[model samples]
Structure formats: structure tokens, C-alpha cells
Target: MITLNHYLFVSGALFALGLAGVVVRRNIIIIFMCLEMMLSAANLALVGFSRFRVTDGLPDYAAQSLVFFTITVAAAEVAVGLAVIVALYRTRQSVEVDTITRMRG
Candidate 1:
């Protein structure tokens, strides 16, 4: 039988992987994906906790509602991040982090 600890461990592992990707990758697109991964990991943990915390044999709706809100936020973030990335790519012709590091005035 799966337990809350198991869910939490998986969530932690996914978050770590996402964090590593964000730190090590130079491309903005990859970094964006990693950020989404981190969000997903958080959502999973929330759902797991909500599922385990039974109230009269029913999972808590509050956590699930929060998860929905989080999903909405993540979706919005992706749309905005992609737009920014596209603009950067058009101006620089590259999506690498180094291209954006040095500012031109």
C-alpha cells in the first residue's frame, strides 16, 4: 500500500531533478520546462496530502482547490514565459542564457 511518505519522496525527487535542470541548463526553454516540472512536483505533493487527509472518508477539497489554482497559475506562467522566450529569440537569434547576460546600451 502506498503511503504519504512515498508520495512525498517521489515529489522531492522530481523537484530536485527540476532544480538541477534549471541550474545546469543554459537554454531559456529548458529552464522554463524545469520550472514547470517543479510546479508539477508541488502539485503532486498537494494532491497526495489531500488524498491521505481523510474527512469523513472524503479527501479534503481545500487542498484540491489549491491544486487547481496552482495549475491555472502554471498555465499562465507557461504562456507568458514562452512569449518572452520568443521575443528574446527573435532579437538575439539564440535562446542561450549567455546571450541575455550582457546588456547592451
Candidate 2:
């Protein structure tokens, strides 16, 4: 049977992979995707803990509500982030992080 530990392990693995991607990849878009992956990992862990923890018969929705808020914020982040990426690409013609350092002007 799947348990909280299993969910936590999966979340941890996903977070680690996302971290690695963000650190190793040169493309801004991939880094943004990895950031989203990390967020998803956190959300999974939150939901798992909320589902497994005993609440003395009360309906525990705090974590779930937080997850919803997180999702909303992530959505907005993606919209704005992608727009910025597109603009950067239009100006630089490349998505590599190193190429953006000259944008000091």
C-alpha cells in the first residue's frame, strides 16, 4: 500500500532532480520548468502529509488550501515568466543564461 513515506520519497526525488536541472542546465526555459517541478514536489508532500495526519475527526484542509494558493501563484508566475522569456529571446535570439548577462543597459 502506498504510504506517506512513499509520497515523501517521491517528492524528495523529484525535488532533487529539479534542483539538478536548474543548476546544470543553461537554458532559461528548462530552468523555469525545473522550478515548477520543485513546486510540484512541495505540493505533493504537503498533500500527502495532510492526507495521512490524524486530525481528531476534523476535516483538515489547511494544506490543501495552501496547495491551491500555491497553484494559483505558480500559474501567474508561469504566465509572467514565459512572457519575459519570450521578450528576452526576441532581443537576444538565445535562451542561454550566459547570453543575458549583457542586458545591464
Candidate 3:
């Protein structure tokens, strides 16, 4: 049977991986993907906690609602972020963060 700790552990591991990817990767797209992964990990943990702590098997609606909000925010972030990335790519011909430093005023 899956326990709360098990879910927490997996979520933590996934979040760590995402953080590593964001820190180590040079590409903007990959960094965005990593951020998404981290958000997903948080959502998983939230749902897991809600499910495991509640007496009823139906699970908590609050956590699920929060997850929906998180997903919406993530979607909006991706849309705006990807648009910026595309603009940067068009102007610089690359999506690498290092190449964008010259744009600093």
C-alpha cells in the first residue's frame, strides 16, 4: 500500500531533480520544463497529503482545487514565458541564458 511518506519522498525527489535541471541546464526551454516539473511535484505532494490525512476515502476537495489553480498558473506562465523565449530566439538566434547577458542595460 502507498503511504504518505512514500508519496512525500517521491515528490521531494522529483522536485530536487527539477531544481537541478533548472540550475545546471543552459537552455531556457529546458529550464522552463524543469520549473514545470517542480510545480507538478508540489501538486502531487499536496494531493497525497490531502488524501492520506482525511478520514473519508473521497479525498479533500481543497487540495484538488489548489492543484487546479496551480495548473492554471503554470499554463499562464508557460504561455507568457514561451512567448518571451520565442522573441529572444528570434533576436539572438539562440535560447541560451549566457547569450542574453549582453542585453542588460
Candidate 4:
């Protein structure tokens, strides 16, 4: 049968993948995506723990609330990050990290 440990392991794997992406990628947009992926991994573990803990007939609204807040903030982050990328692209003519470093207002 599935267990909380199983979910935790899966989440850990996903988080590790995201971390690798963030560390290895030079592109800013890809790093942002990796950050989002890491957040999703945390959410999975939170929900899994909440579900297991609430088996005693208690409410698990906390986990749901946390996930909701995470998603809201992630959406905001993506919107702002994309805007920055767009602005950088316009100023530099390319979205690459090397070109972006030379960007000026």
C-alpha cells in the first residue's frame, strides 16, 4: 500500500531534479521554471502528509490553504519574471544570459 514515505520520496526526487535544472541552466527563463517545479514538489509532500494526518477525522484545511497560497505566489512570480525577461529581451535583442548581462536601460 502507498504511504507517506512514498510520497516524500517522490517529492524529494522531483525537488532534486528542479535543483539540478536551476544549477545547470544558464537561461533565466529555465531557472524560473525550475523554481516553480521545486515549489510543486513541496506541495505534493504537504498534501500527502495532510491526508495521512487527517485520517483521525480532523480537518486538513491547513495543507489545502498552504497549497493555494503557494500557487497564488507562484503565479505572481511567473508573471513578473516573464515581464523581466521580455524587458531584457527588448533591451538586449536576445534572452541569453550572456547578452542580458550587457543590457542597459
Top TM-score: which candidate number?
1
Q: Quick one: ranking by TM-score, best first?
A: 1, 3, 2, 4
The sequence of per-residue lDDT tens digits that candidate 2 reaches over residues 20-41 is 9999999999999999999999
Give the clashing pairs for model 4: none
Candidate 2 regions off by >4 Å? 56-59
| Global Cα RMSD, each model | 1.3, 1.4, 1.6, 1.8
lDDT of 4 at 51: 84
TM agreement with the true structure for every prediction: 0.94, 0.91, 0.91, 0.88
Q: lDDT tens digits, residues 13-73, model 1?
A: 9999999999999988999999999999999999999999999999989999999999999
lDDT of 4: 0.88
- Considering lDDT, which of the candidate structures 2 and 3 is the better prediction for this target? 2
Alpha-carbon deviation at 21 in model 4, angstroms: 0.5
The lDDT per prediction is 0.93, 0.93, 0.92, 0.88
How accurate locally is residue 82 in candidate 2, as Cα lDDT from 0 to 100? 100
lDDT of 2 at 40: 98
Off by over 4 Å in 4: 55-59, 102-104
RMSD of 2: 1.4
